[model samples]
Target: MREADRTTRQRLADALRAEPATPSELAAQFDLTPNAVLGHVEHISRSLDRSDERFLVAPPTCRDCGFDDFDDLLNLPSRCPGCKSEAVTEPTFTIE
Candidate 1:
């Protein structure tokens, strides 16, 4: 389908299926805010629950200590619990 013919959520799902990408990356590609991309991701994830495909998230990690375990996997934390670093990478999402 043409890009203009599809909904925002549908475009987002198609992007994820192509390759894993962070919210920031997707936001820029789709011309939306990171928060907006997150919202689309949440909806797409729910829709995929019944399908054989899976919505996978490579959780955010701290640039300082490389910590990837956070209480909330979707949102980016200001500080890393392991290293207390302010530099944290946003989680990458992909459909597998």
Candidate 2:
């Protein structure tokens, strides 16, 4: 099927199954904003809960101090709580 014909969530799921990717990567692949991709990913996570597959998250980290203690895995933080740095790495997701 043509990529344009597929739903955004379907495209996101397909990309993630093919390989683990950050939200930014998915956003680029789906031609969406990173925040938009996060919304789809959140729904994907819930959908996987009732299926045989599972959604895996590689939690975002603070590039400055290697902090990975963000309470919410679905939303990217603007700054690190540990070092107060804005250089935080986006979380990666995959299906397994």
Candidate 3:
């Protein structure tokens, strides 16, 4: 990535570190479109490549209990198969 892009990414990460912001919030903060912010996040996730960071982009989660899975929780159901809840909780990437 270019120097400017790197700087932007770092700033974004810093902002996220302070609080788990959704993509729309980040975009608005940086005067960028939501899609652009998402692109930057995707790049950052790939660059980190840390085993601990699992649901960086496509937030993997249970498809039944509406449970959220992040760096903290790794073992989550695939389809809420046990409960048959089917109330999957998808990650909120946008503030609104």
Q: Give the whole-model CA lDDT for all candidates, comma-separated.
A: 0.91, 0.93, 0.57
lDDT of 2 at 52: 97
Candidate 1 minimal-lDDT segment of 10 residues: 69-78
What shift in Å separates residue 47 of candidate 1 from its native position after superposition?
Answer: 0.9
**TM-score attained by model 1:** 0.92
TM-score, model 2 to reference: 0.93
Worst lDDT window (10 residues) for model 3?
A: 69-78
Off by over 4 Å in 3: 1-6, 50-96
User: What ranges in model 2 sit over 4 Å off?
Assistant: 1-4
All candidates: TM-score: 0.92, 0.93, 0.50
The Cα RMSD in angstroms, rounded to one decimal, for candidate 3 relative to the true structure is 7.8
Which segments of model 1 are wrong by more than 4 Å?
Answer: none
Give the range of the ten consecutive residues with the poorest summed lDDT in model 2: 22-31
lDDT of 1 by residue, 22-82 (tens): 9999999989999889888998999999999999999998988989989887785779999
Clashes of 1: 0
> In candidate 2, what are the lDDT values of residues 1-96, reduced to their tens digit?
998799889889998999999989988877899999999999999999999999999999998899998999998899999989999999999998
